[model samples]
Target chain A: MDAFQAIADPSRREILRLLSRDTMTINALADNFDMSRPAVSKHIKALDSAGLISIQNIGKERYCILNQEGFDELQEWIDYFDTFWKSKLKKLEMLLNEKAGK
Target chain B: MNRDIVHRWQFRQSPEIVWEHLTKPELLSQWLMANDIKPEVGHKFRFTTNPLLKFGFDGIVYCEVLEVDPPKRLSYSWKGGPGNGKIALDSLVTWTLTLKDGGTELLLEHTGFSGMKNYFGYLMMKNGWGSKIRKRLGALLAGPGK
Candidate 1:
């Protein structure tokens, strides 16, 4: 999934907002949400997969922090235009339809 | 580290028909922006769009024809923004068309986003890049153990 899809969820966005403030263990991060630990873990996994967060095993516990490098790769203007093109191309499709009708 | 954005679409039109939309300046503007586009290599062109000066978008894009394979491929440099001895946005847009069963398959690859500076310049185009991603970047700047 793209970074947008990863953060599309409100809960995941909240998790990112929390991580933006400071690094926290998975358990601590889970406590902020009113959901199952496993659900929170799933969200973290999604963020980690999308390069939105970094998970480090600090001895017995795993810590999660916002991945700075991941954000760098995603902030490209093209990322926004990726969506823009989708819409623009749809308009192109419509124009093609009009031309075909004529 | 390549941040190219690729968008693919399958249209119900022949590659030859789609080629016109990609090559003809008037047809191209219907979907993209107004331009003096020509289908010859090394040809220079300027794409003009609605002005959004507040975001640093002077409604102009400087371009040059890079590659042209009529009905199959087209590539060009895409650059714009305040030019004051510093290049704000510089990239390439390549369009590839493939003949399909009943229509054409189009692929757009826009590449060359290298560093943090370019990233911001891109956001400042029309969308509030600062409001959208700055929180995350700001956090990265103030990251723990940094």
Candidate 2:
């Protein structure tokens, strides 16, 4: 699942909301949600796959922390063109300026 | 994320000169990439560039002129990708030249960045996600991640 699909769910977005503030274990995270532990786990797993969170094993407990990887793909697409269009236009401007100068 | 890219520039040159630079393949290669672009509508062409492996694009943009109005407006279908000629980005590129008081006004709009399958769900994620999510994560990310 991509970031958008992962975030489409309110529960998963809540999970992201919680993780962004503090790193928490599955049990602690499940306690905040009214859903079944396994269901929350499924959501957590989806967030992990979407690169929204990173899971780490601290002893027997697994901790989930918010990550930026999820936003990279979406942000990068726009940023690429942002730079590309600006630079390409700059080049075009220079071409016109040079021709007029001559 | 970005729905479209729009750029407008003022040039002392005339619209006719700007139109030539836009439609002529040889002049186009100077500003854009090397391509066999013709002003005629329905003409097919492609721009050759280095492969952008990170973005899943081979860097060559295949195009077809959808509309043409000399010295006024032009549009084309832009499609490209790699692997058996798969199309990753299928978009519309448009250019408009309007005569201004002193010279020509060039406008470019490159749209349709949301159609990619993996990014399709994001159409709602833009407005639906809203400022709530950003407000929640902004402080956290700004604190340590910056």
Candidate 3:
């Protein structure tokens, strides 16, 4: 599943929000939801497949935390034009500087 | 994600100089893509860049001026995708220029990234902007990425 599909579900997005604050065990994450444990597991698998969250095993528990790989591109895309204008304006500054010198 | 992009820059030039760079088609093509932009409300323009046939992008951004306040603000509609006449992403790009302490400050806001299918194009747009800003403008300034 892609990052877009991973975020399509509200439950998955909630999981991401919770994990962003702090790492949560699979059971802890599942407890926060109103669905079955298997259903929650299904969502986690989808998130895992999308590389949005990472599951780590410590002793008997699997902890899920937010992954940087998730939505990095999305965030970049959202901020793309902002950067574009900055660069464009910077070039404008150079042209203005040349005009001032002459 | 909010999907809204806002950025601001300060240049040591008057609003008129910066405004010319924004509204003049020739100056815009030097910095942005090739376009026949005019400084008037309701003017239609198109920006052409390197074609991305594989990603369904014809590298053409069709635009129409929505607002024009000379030496102050300019807004336009941006739509780009495959040349099939189908709009891949429909968004608005606004530019605001303000005179400051013998200089000008420019603010840009691009919004309206709706739905999931457009996300891919959005990602490509991000890379395209990043590269252009970092590469082309950086080359002109000689030290932007630093």
lDDT of each: 0.75, 0.77, 0.73
Off by over 4 Å in 1: A1-76, B52-55, B115-146
Estimate, for each residue in B12-125, the C-alpha lDDT of model 3 and write its tens digit: 878998898888888888777889999778999999988755334578989999999999999999887667786645778999999999898888888765323354334335
Q: What TM-score does structure 3 among the candidates reach?
A: 0.57
Candidate 2 residue spans exceeding 4 A from truth: A1-53, A63-72, B117-146
Where does candidate 1 clash, by residue pair? none
- CA error at residue B79 for candidate 2, angstroms: 2.3
- Candidate 2 lDDT by residue in tens digits, B27-135: 9999989999988888999998898766667788889999999989999998876546766566789999999986999998987654343343343354353454466
The A-chain TM-scores of all the candidates are: 0.71, 0.74, 0.71
Q: Order of candidates by lDDT, top first?
A: 2, 1, 3
TM-score (chain A only) of candidate 1: 0.71
> What is the clash count for each candidate, in the order shown?
0, 0, 0
Tens-digit lDDT track of model 3 for A1-102: 566558668788778767756789999999999999999999999999888889999999999977765545434544565676677767767777887899
User: How much of the true A–B contact set does each candidate keep?
Assistant: 0.37, 0.30, 0.35
Docking class of 3: incorrect
